[model samples]
Target: MAGRLRCPNCAAPLRLAGRVLRCAGGHAFDVARQGYVALAPPRRRLAPGDSPEMVAARETFLAGGHYRAIAEAITEATPAELIPSAGGAPLALDLGAGTGYYLAALLDDRSGWQGIALDASRPALRRAVRAHPQIAAVACDVWQELPVQDACADLLLNAFAPRNGPEIARVLAPSGALVVVTPTQSHLREIVDALGLLDVDADKQGRLHAALAPRLQSERRRELEFTMTLDHEQLRALIAMGPSAHHLQPRQVAERLARLPQRMRVGASLLIETFRRSGAAGASA
Candidate 1:
């Protein structure tokens, strides 16, 4: 876990000792029995991320393979996966790696690489730690400085989560690449009206570019759209696993879901993109 991670307090390299990760400056964090280390600064008490229910819902929904295509696209767009024989075994970092589903895919194609799954949610990291044997899970706020070393990660991944552009560019290896997955408004179109879901940001793509700026260069972008026929329980899990779960009451969820058919078809759309450090040779537009 300390392979590419730095101490949250001192930003020094961390070394594992017994059940704790410690920096040369004496800052120490105990690794939980659940196999994840929480790296958030203790004083700030950053707000909790995905709740237990949300994590469970996501685990269930993803295990259903509804978004398998999206995961595959993320892995395919990653440049590092193709060069598994790179000098040192490459490292892949997943920002807001939820349950490690996408990271798992990337690792599947790259035999020798290891993955670091970063998420604010302990519940998500817990699942991530268990999702794959080669994955190391860390709990850290995405908006805060990531507890990772500079220019260490060979690949970075972001899926349906926040992106910290500067932190991302700083952590990526000079020759590394980044893959991001964001949903288009067309995603779950049928459920949007029925479930009172939040509207997908209209300027999401424009804002993404602005945030990364000259620090990162865009390489490729593609939209993969698909359909799913979800049953009653599947529909409920789909809504519960998203941001809507925070605002929707149980009664409201039940009431809205009650009106929808037992099984309904919905479109799934994701904008997948790949980027490289701006100064990298042949960095794309």
Candidate 2:
């Protein structure tokens, strides 16, 4: 994984030596004991990704298999056949890969696939590194220039996270595919209404298409819709695991949860879409 990384400062190839990764130009980053690296630039103005509490909640909820259907859809939708065989092991870059749950499942389905789980949060990367032995986790801001070299990744994954269109285009191999999972307007509507959480923007899809224009062309799109009957604990974890956690206080969340039914049918709806580098002939399955 270190071999695949470049120095964010100099864009020089990095080599792992003991606990440090150093480039020929003398730039260095220390690898954490838990086996993840930080490549984000020293100064950042934006708030950090997910906090420890959020990551913990997410880990717990995902471990219970609440989102198994969505994870399965992503794994099945990935076009592993399109990846070039020239690379020793095809690399799958999981951008904003919190906890690496989806990437871990994909690696399990695709033999010989290696993963790089990139996130802006150290807490998320800590868990991501342990998700699979084949995964190498990196803590870096996706909004900035990625630490990855050009045209190296066979598959780039962005699931319910911010997208960096140009960075994604630059890192993906010509024949590679990009998989994104976004929530539709009706997704988790019941939960949102019940707790007064943030709403999914009505024009999110249109905005996404505009953002990717002329750089990535759509290859496939699938809508996964399901219902989960969640108990109080499940519901609480679900809320704590998402953006709502940032807005609502613990007392407010508890009050809302207490008013809701003990068991409720929650809608889980998401769009799993795939794209290819613009102007590249669609790879045959």
Candidate 3:
């Protein structure tokens, strides 16, 4: 499947040779020893996505099975049999995939499916590479053109990450589907109110539709809501795993967390929307 990748520099097809990927245009990217590749263009102005501390917190929190319901919802929404694998096994690209928790679970049930976990954080990519044997990690900024060939992805997963609508449309095959998981307003409301965490945007769904309009059409939308019992430590990790960690200082967070109850009921509410290429038959669901 690496043959379907394009060089970030020149958009030429990349060939994997040993530990390096080289394009006919002479641009080369080296695969890390941990089995991931960094495909961001050189010298581009890019902000770091997630810090090591944030990545570690996410890895810990996800390992505890706190969000297994969300993962299951995504897996159920993506039907493996719908994808055709005659050319090769279907390739599932997880854009802004953090720890690859959801993608790993999705791939586990699909026998021949392969996964690519793309994120801007090196720390996150390190853990993503080890998520599963069939998974490959790539460090790239999702806002820019993805380092993937046109119409090469069978499934695209975006969970709590930036939405690069045009790039997504370019990478999805004709029969491909994109599964987006965004937090609803009530998601973690308790923590947001108590800790002053970032709130979900009021017009997120409208904005999402606008961003994806004219290229991809919504197929289905499902809401998954649940409650989690979290201790102080778990709560802290949860806070650190999201954008809230960037806004609040460590001291402020610690003081706030200390005042909370030993155990708290945290809300987990999200909207999982599936989209198909525009003009496809039975586009709406």
Instruction: Name every residue pair that clashes in candidate 3.
Output: none
Q: Is 1 or 2 the stronger prediction by TM-score?
A: 2
Q: Write the per-residue lDDT of candidate 1 for residues 14-62, one digit (tens) a residue.
A: 9999999999999998999999998877697855889999999999999
Which residue segments of model 3 deviate by more than 4 Å? none
Give candidate 2's error at residue 183 in angstroms: 0.4
Candidate 1 has which clashing residue pairs, if any?
A: none
Give the poorly placed runs of model 2, Cα more than 4 Å off. Answer: 44-47, 283-285
Compose the digit string of candidate 3's lDDT tens values, residues 180-276.
Answer: 9999999999999999999999999999999999899888999999999999999989999999998998899999999999999999999999898
TM, every model: 0.96, 0.96, 0.97
Candidate ranking under TM-score, highest first, comes to 3, 2, 1
Candidate No. with top lDDT: 3
Ranked by lDDT, the better of candidates 1 and 3 is 3
List the lowest-lDDT window of 10 residues for candidate 3. Answer: 79-88
Looking at model 1, report the run of 10 residues with the lowest lDDT sum. Answer: 79-88
lDDT (Cα, tens digit) per residue for candidate 2, span 1-285? 777889988899999999999999998899999889988666654339999999999999999998999889998888857655336789999999999999999999988789999998889989998999899998888988999988888899999999888899889988888999999989889989989999998888888788787788888999999999999899889999898898999899999999999999999989999988777768323
